[model samples]
Target: MVLQMSSNQANPNTYMGSVVASNDVVIQVNDLHKCYQSYPKPIHRLWQSFMPKRRFYQEFWALKGIDLTVHKGETVGIVGKNGSGKSTLLQVIAGILQPTKGSFTTKGRISALLELGAGFNPEFTGMENARLNASIMGLTREEFHDKLPDIVEFCGLGDFLHRPVKTYSSGMYVRLAFAVAINMNPDILIVDEALAVGDVRFQRQCFRRIEQLKEQGVSILFVTHSTESVIKYCDRAIMLDDGELKLTGSPKEVVQAYLELMFGSEKDTDALVKVDVENYKVEFDPSIDNCPKQASYNSGEHRWGDSRAKICYYEIFQNGAASNGLMQRGDQLVIRMWSLFEQDVDNLIYGITVKTNDGNAIYGTNSRALEVETPAQRAGDLVVVEFRLKLNLLAGDYFISLGVAQDHDVKDNIAIDRRYDLIHVHIRETLDAFGIADLEGDLSITLED
Candidate 1:
């Protein structure tokens, strides 16, 4: 399912421009085209038999006239719905699938965690497959022997690493595949949602390893559906649709545009939603036009979206001071949400989550998380929700996300009001000091002498 949410938020229009403002090119993709010959229909197939086999051939272009470039050390993301030719592009990049026309170039050793069981033989034992998997990734028997222990440890497969490849669970298969790919020491690592194969713990492990690769200046091309992950990990992102590159920019902007296209038409979706987010401006007053200086906002970090809900209003307040995305350390951060109901909805809930600049959830609070609920509201009822919590974070960028739920907390309902108002905080907290909050810890020093 394409899980999407948009919330009422106060955000700036400057985000889309900030995405491509950088100058770098690590991966250059020229007029790349990959087309597969499709067979004709049954009647056409029979007719082609009477005529010639050539008559039944139809060209289905997967990658058509593509041009792009990746800067050195850039972590580029590839996002598109299923059957969007993402897999085909990666396969061509890995040289596993040949392009029908045009040419592309990569200046480094390549490693990929594409599809599971990509090179493994089902009949082979896990141990046998492990060796073969590493070899196919460009390692000799001796090098794999030296790195075997590390892969086993990272994968956490334990004895299962020695078991038959076919006997492993789907999760185990992914873990092994990831372990082998990362340990093979590739200069250009390509990951295609294979990281989602394992458990949360394993997923965390894979991300940490990806971090290591990035630090070492290894170029990465990741294809995933998780907008949050793309914003967190990718230096930049490229969005594709129908084998065509649509938007290229920072994760949030691309994700927002992609979501609007996937969920519905780019226009106002009041039918599927209730709150009219276009009229929802809460933090900065209408006079500011989303600027930080003129309004209560003191910082510039923020994100926004329409969680698919008719998100009406979202505001951030610190000690009664109105702000869009600025919060000081040791202050009480209060997020207020207001939405107009368009239906007799049951189990309607509002939630707010705070994340660091890199997209780490500092904390989250929802109406249902507190076991609170509002009586069923009418079509015109305006629902207001607020969350108050302590702001305790080291100085860095951060974002706020608002969500609307119909039944459960999951985005099963027509979550419309997913807004990403930019949140930039001047964290006055000192991190070297102990404790979760920025409050100075109790310390004592006594001279025995």
Candidate 2:
């Protein structure tokens, strides 16, 4: 693997450079490109080697003209669909693979947990692999010993550490790997999807460690399919499409764009234009006359969709009366949403989500999950949906997101109309609860003679 020199030493287009000049920039990638040779058959590989320049294979570019910079303490998330070159870019940055055309520079020691058991020797014991990996990361014997206790405690592999790595389960493999990588004290951490293999407890532990590392000014490049994790942990995010850098921005914006790329269709724009014109002519129905005013509505709510269907009116009720955006904890509540269809649609799905003030989803449900079969509807038809449930939420401000979408077999639902955080509801104080929800626990005591 060749590391390109500074901009002065090499072509500016392909220069990776060291972190010598920039104090804050930890990782910089400029016009990076990577390609692989694809042969039609196994025999073609041998033929290509024998024929040399005689073109027995085609070039498959895995990365193309990727330019990125990671500042100190910045956690940049990489999100894309499968085969989008996420892993390829990371491998190049980690110096595990040589770039075919372009270059990228890294300032400090990088500890990457790219693939499961990637650096491990199957014949070696877990402890031996850990020592070898630590050494490879530039840790001395003293340093490795110093961190050994911490790694052992974190991984919780116990006696299994003496066993060959090939005998470990997928979860066990990630645990030991993560423990070593994080304990290496590198200035940059590159984590792929390896964290997904661990149990929830271990995952939480790893994230907590990652948060600590971020606070310590370690730049991190995280790649995952979980959009929620990106929104929750990342400062900025980049989306890739077909080996190309597509969009880069705040986490929410990038994730939204990625989702739109995945699930949104060209019809969305046309439907939105049509709905905007018809919205002015439509009048509110009398049934929802008591709906709360604009004060209860979230002005910063994000709304998008094809607009084939529009949520016209929405109201929340407690004790059979219109709610004023306030309700007691554990109160039985009713949520009503009215949608107007602008075009004929079938296999409709109505969904709702309850989220914290900080945008963490507490609970969500949809008609499809409840197995409610919805019939096809014609244009100009009005659909009213009512959801009745107990608001067992803790005392805090919460937001409700509503959506109407059409079912699709290949991907997620096609959004007819989706309103995120449209309604703001405040849960009044009640019996002490610790977390997001009140599970309503009961206590019993047995006396022994």
Candidate 3:
């Protein structure tokens, strides 16, 4: 069902830059700017209003010239560091805050789970608050009545739902708040990072409910610091840096860009070099022809680092033969990365992580972890780092990521270059397994008389 609410916001014809909204767009923002007037003293706020020419307040732009569009039934993740205006943008879209310059339009019944218990009154009972929240979310009287029982049951509060909200614990607060928000059947769900307060079980339940909502064609804008949630749930992601849009793309790629913005130095992401490894020869295992023969490294995959060094190419070798994507259980595998040092560096460390398709880490290793000492590197030098390990994994899809960092005394752990999901491999099912890894343990069943 397509539920829409009339938008009284600014005209859709106005734009901040070149952003144009399409017919399927549910939220359209053009040249959106939100600023707060900060005063040095409480009296200055009054003085600035009357002084006109004399400015007594400092302007802090929470959002600056932001233009974006969110299509229907899309779950977009918003990520940024603290003070990056992630919450501010969400509030603006949720209609809690008005724009300072530009205008935005939002369609549908928007229910926002922003700050914890934002719409609830402390003195009100949980039932009263739930009713109030449902009304605010545009639920009809009969609709809320029909869904109230389900909401109460999902919250698992029993008689506590009749108690005042002030007496509730933080976990209970989240349960009631989330229950009301989801049961109201909003067309657009806006969630901030408030779910972290709930316990693990409740958090998982909330994720499942959100997934259900997405399947029902509800648009969701989720703001979180959890990169795993973005990669696992969101179809698209946007990174905001100091109130500016830094990147917008697929979840994995955007998460990679966000990590680079946080951990590595800012550099051109398009800078790349090709590896010429044709001269190197390795004995082939002709029987293993099903393995992927090449790594899918392209501009679609996020890459970033300082220009001091770069990873030219990375490849996986199956049983001494170069392969990319196919593998079997208990097979000997070698991961080789060719790196070129563009500038002199004292010491370099190589790291690799084997992860599930959803970004869960199965195994990870680094030069520092393996007790291997890296020699000093000079400019115009090429180095090949290889990791050989038995593929003791179950039948599933997995990814390998590569990173190179410079070790220093004062400022250690500087990334020279890093690439996420550098290669993909699928472990062919050979044994009946259920979990992550094949421990290769013997099973014995004996019953005592």
TM-score of each: 0.72, 0.86, 0.77
Q: Of the pair 2 and 3, which is ahead by lDDT?
A: 2
The TM-score that candidate 1 achieves is 0.72
Error of 1 at 337 (Å): 3.7
Which has the greatest lDDT? 2
lDDT score, residue 32, model 1? 79
Write model 1 residue lDDT over 1-449, tens digit each, in one string. 01011111122111112122233433456677888866756687677778884567787788877776776577988888888888889887676776777666554566677787776777776677777766555567898899988977887877776678788788888877777777776667888888786789889888998998999988899999888888889988888888888888887677667665555323353554333434544453322223334243324433333333345445678877875555566778876666666555666667777776556566777776688865776655566677887777656556666666555333343444554443445555454764334555578899998
Ranking of models by lDDT: 2, 3, 1
Prediction RMSDs, each to the true structure: 9.9, 4.9, 6.6
Error of 1 at 258 (Å): 2.9
* Per-residue C-alpha lDDT of model 2 across residues 1-449, encoded as one tens digit per residue: 10111122222212344333476877888788999999899999999789997998899999999989989899999999999999999888887788887667777777888887788898999999988887776678998899999999999999999999999999999999888888888788899998988999999999999999999998899999988899889999999999999999999888877877777745534542233333434356522322345467887777788877778788788878887788888788898888877788899999999988876788899999999999887766777899887898888999998889989987768887888888898988766566678888788899999
Full candidate order by TM-score, most accurate first: 2, 3, 1
* Weakest lDDT window of 10 consecutive positions for candidate 3: 1-10
Listed per model in order, the count of residue pairs whose N, CA or C atoms clash below 3 Å is: 47, 0, 1
TM-score: which candidate is best?
A: 2
Q: Pairs clashing in candidate 2?
A: none
How many backbone overlaps does candidate 3 show? 1
lDDT of 2: 0.82
